[model samples]
Target: MNVPKASEKECIILTISGRVQGIGYRRSAQQKAESLGLTGWVANLENGDVRMVAEGTPDQVDALELWCRNSGPRMARIDRVEVVRQQASGVFVGFVIR
Candidate 1:
C-alpha cells in the first residue's frame, strides 16, 4: 500500500449496479482500493449491486470512483458509479472483499 504523506485523508462511499454481483466486483474493488492505498471494504448487496467505502487522498478517491465507472473485473459490466462524500471514519485498516 502506498501510504499517503499526510494525515488529511478523505473518504467516499460508492454504490454501483448492473452486473455488479456474482461477477467478482467486490474482489476487483478490493484490489483497486489496495493498489491505491485506500482503506475500505467492498461488498455485494442483495439487490445485485455493489457498495464500498474508500478512504485516502482526495485524488485517489476520485480515481477509484472513476475506475468504477467501467473498469473492474473483466466480467463486471458496470453501468454507473454513484459517489457520496462523507466524513472519514478512520476505521478500516486495509481493503477487504466482503
Candidate 2:
C-alpha cells in the first residue's frame, strides 16, 4: 500500500515475454513510452524476452506497464510481464531501442 504521489517521479524495469522479439516490440515500446511523455529504453534480451526501463510519474509508468501486459507490439504475443519498481535514475533523455 505504498502509493506514490501524483507528481512523484519514478522508474520501473519490465521484462516481457512471449514472441517479443522481431515484432517491432522495441520500436513500438519506444513509441509508446514517448507518447506517454516518459524517458526510457527498450531492448531485446538474449533469452527471447523484452526489457523496458521507463522513468516518469507513477501514473505514466503504470499506464505503460498495463499496455505491455495486455496489448504489446502489434504482432506480438505477450504471455507474461515482470515488473520491478526502482529508484529513478535521472539520466534518460528519451526512449530508445537498445
TM-score of each: 0.88, 0.89
Error of 1 at 93 (Å): 0.5
Which ten-residue region of model 2 has the weakest summed lDDT?
1-10
What is the alpha-carbon lDDT of model 2 when measured against the actual structure? 0.88
Candidate 2 lDDT, 24-79, residue by residue in tens? 88888888899998898888899999999999988899999999988876799988
Q: Which ranges of candidate 1 are over 4 A from the true structure?
A: 1-7
Please state the error at residue 91 of candidate 1 in Å. 1.5
Model 2 deviation from native, Cα RMSD in Å: 4.5
lDDT of 1: 0.85
Best by lDDT: 2
